[model samples]
Target: MAGIRFSQLIDNFITTIERYGSTVLQPEISSSRPANIRVITSEQVTDCKIFLWTITPGGGGPGVRPESERRIQMTNISGMPLWPGVRTLLGGWSQEFGVYAFWDARRHTKFSFRSPSLQVDANTLETAGTTGIATQFRPTKEGEEVVVAVAPGSLLWYVQNGLPLHNSQDDAAFVVDLAAASPEEERNFLDSAQSEIESARRYDLVETMRAFRDASFRPAVLQAYSYKCAVCNCDLKLVDAAHIVPITHPTSTDEVTNGIALCRLHHGAYDNALLGVKSDCQIVINPNMTNRLHEIGLDSGLEEFKSRLPDVIRVPASIEARPTPDRLRLGLKLRGWPEEQIA
Candidate 1:
């Protein structure tokens, strides 16, 4: 038969669901690309089976290229569940039109999952297959139903049951505590995440997690330090949340105590081991930095930092939020500074 008319079909489908709930049925030609024959049993009553045909492109139909793009702006159809029958019938339609899917644990702590076709890696219906088969159905915050064809990047933190999905188990190899990942480490993570995406067929799950972490954690650090550079009190918006313990360390990376707000200058210095924090919270300029800056004739910036040495860093509002002395010592050690307490 001609391709399925998506608008009329979906409208009727939703109406049927609302008017009378749907029942699972077997497909006559089940293994086809788009299942040709299927059955729906509802209380409204119909003994004859429902036969669905291949979804075809309609002139001005919603799932067509232009119509689909515009429909993305409409929130009415967001978060619709794609049951087995619907998956067989409209899955190809959704893909042809760019409908995406994503799922998350009810809690924000665990990793999330997304439909594979959304990524740069793959896009064809043949590539995506079934949601479970395509993505291997990563564990959600338990009891959460799979949400199909959501707006691009929409996440489901809580399941339909209202329970928060939290995954406490950590995979040390893939999941690192990155307070603020170093440039190299960040690149490594991106590559690793990409590999995971391709291997597990999860398109943008890692990217989504990275975005969520930045949005929630960095602001907390900046606010904890009162939006000023913890080392030199630079108040510019250029201040950053620097991780005291390198993100590679096997500890919580996003905590305010593991972070210190620093301007771009100090952040770069700390990252490069040109600056170090003492056990007493004093900021020290690395001896190598002084020589290097003098050699490069870029010595003016040192006056501000050098004068601040022996003076303690600006502490956060809460004592518990202060960078731990052990982490500070770790920072000094990374800079090759003397371990003896500075006189």
Candidate 2:
């Protein structure tokens, strides 16, 4: 029985996301069998795991039966060590769905689906019934082989929606509908997702949601600003999607209206209160920094920043992507800038 190569699976995954206008960043293949791959989001934070298990015929259960009832057999792969960083079977929705573990029988470490009657002993881990985790993978028959073909839009939605622990088939269909939806309808869907994240009771879930939100937010801001720094217009590797109101603030949001594209230096400056953008889109440098310019070396950099001053910063052509006055005012307030200075 021949099996699919890990590389081919990755190529398929890449093709799926690219079709939906998303790029896979820093893909690291850690294993061949059971296909373990790690990816970084656009934010350059959070390691996402993409693990695939090939379901073979005639495995664990007595099945001279239907194709749908076939179980995925866990074969012992000796000397396989655990890979570092976060490992999730599908997307690490929750403990109830999947878990990170080391296979005692095979000495292999990876993410495994957790069934309701799952048993974990010192030597082996076994499941009593059909696990819900398999539904997300949604293995499909390709040629004569059964392989997991993850839905394209669902892959993107998983990163944006914090891997909601639910029926992935329905979620996949929902995302497909949204892809063809009107702008207002899409916005409403994103808003509803944000509301759910905000109302989440678990701290870990909130953090996961925020990380996922940033994954989408960074790219949106960069695109709105034409992938250039709004302050210095540096379009190189230095640009970063900076929050107008820092993420720690209670009222902070991941919306493009609450974000700005800036180079590393200006981003640091904006966060440190050394630079600011006003509601009228004017770029302002703090007087205190200007008062003692020579004291802080990097005079050339400071001059460059000053040269752009009294200047209206670049804004997104789309009204929705442009920074809102209320968010800018709140951000400035958080920076301790006086109202008179902003006015």
Candidate 3:
């Protein structure tokens, strides 16, 4: 699925409200239907039924402002009292509210509370169940008590350390940012994995949640490096969290220290054993890299890094989180680099 950001959601919400003139409906995270902004139009009665188009904007009648408009008409053909929830879902209530609601003309009063649509189409409702809210991607801890609010389908924000920050910001942008440190630091993969494993075991499930495992590890590694490639210091937001120790080894667990954020090119180089890190946290390109690249006419890509061989990497903040000296030695040993104590 395509990634959606908080800014885009807010912009879409504002645009929908402006275009429709009055009220529009959007899905909540728990909404049964897939998220969509539905415009409420003017009421019209045809034959024995009242037709209201929630899909098309400005087709039925003049849209009413959600913040102020109220005292709506149309009790349907039977003229019976409509459920308050229905009115809320339809964006009928006009009174100022943090949620959606509308007024009832026949009842001569504004209804209280917000309501999301409960439609159950296969592509919509079913699909929504299979996915998460667009803004909330990674897993979070329970009992952490972080205040979060979604502006219906349009936007999402969380209050962290007494400051509000939107998820729309680049993931790297949040790492090490003092204002968001508490929240970002809280996203530890080991903790998340343990939590998920416990949750799954509670249900007696045997299969390991590989997807969940990968999801937890990747973000933890990326955040630790503040989403920048530790080798090149590139902050292009295309970095990958690479494992220092191959998972085939028993000690290769998904710990923050066991991973490094690397760009695609460097990741490939490391995997191919063309690149190695020393116990002193220095990066070393293979001595034969220049000759090899020259033979293949691919020198431009890694020429700079090769020229600057034996450079220091951007070490993580925590000393323990830096690549393990043993792992670095092992990495070079596996690559047949003639270095026993260091790469």
What total of clashing residue pairs does each candidate reach? 4, 0, 8
Tens digits of lDDT, candidate 1, 1-343 = 2444434444343343222112423334333222232223211222221222223333355554443221111111222333342222223223353333323312222223332111111322222332211121234334423322321111111011111111212221232233234445655655654454342322233443344353344567878888788877876456777778776565546677888888777788788777777778866667766787789998776776666654668888798888888777776665566556332
Q: Model 3 — which ten-residue stretch has the worst lDDT?
A: 154-163
Better structure of 2 and 3 per lDDT: 2
| C-alpha lDDT score of every prediction, in listed order | 0.44, 0.51, 0.42
Better of 1 and 3 by TM-score: 1
Worst 10 residues of 2 by lDDT: 123-132
Q: Give the TM-score of candidate 1.
A: 0.42
Model 1 weakest lDDT span, ten residues long: 156-165
Against the true structure, whose lDDT is highest? Answer: 2
Top candidate by TM-score: 2
All candidates: TM-score: 0.42, 0.54, 0.41
lDDT of 3 by residue, 1-343 (tens): 2222334433444353333222344443322211234443222111111111122111234654222212222222222333332321121211122222111122312323332121111222122223311111222221111111222221111000111112112221222222222222333422343455443332221111222233346666877888778888776544777888876565566778778888777787887778878878888767665577779897775756677544778988977777788887776666566554343
The TM-score ranking, best first, is: 2, 1, 3
Residue-level error in angstroms, candidate 3, position 132 = 12
Evaluation by TM-score, superior candidate among 2 and 3: 2
* TM-score of predicted structure 2: 0.54
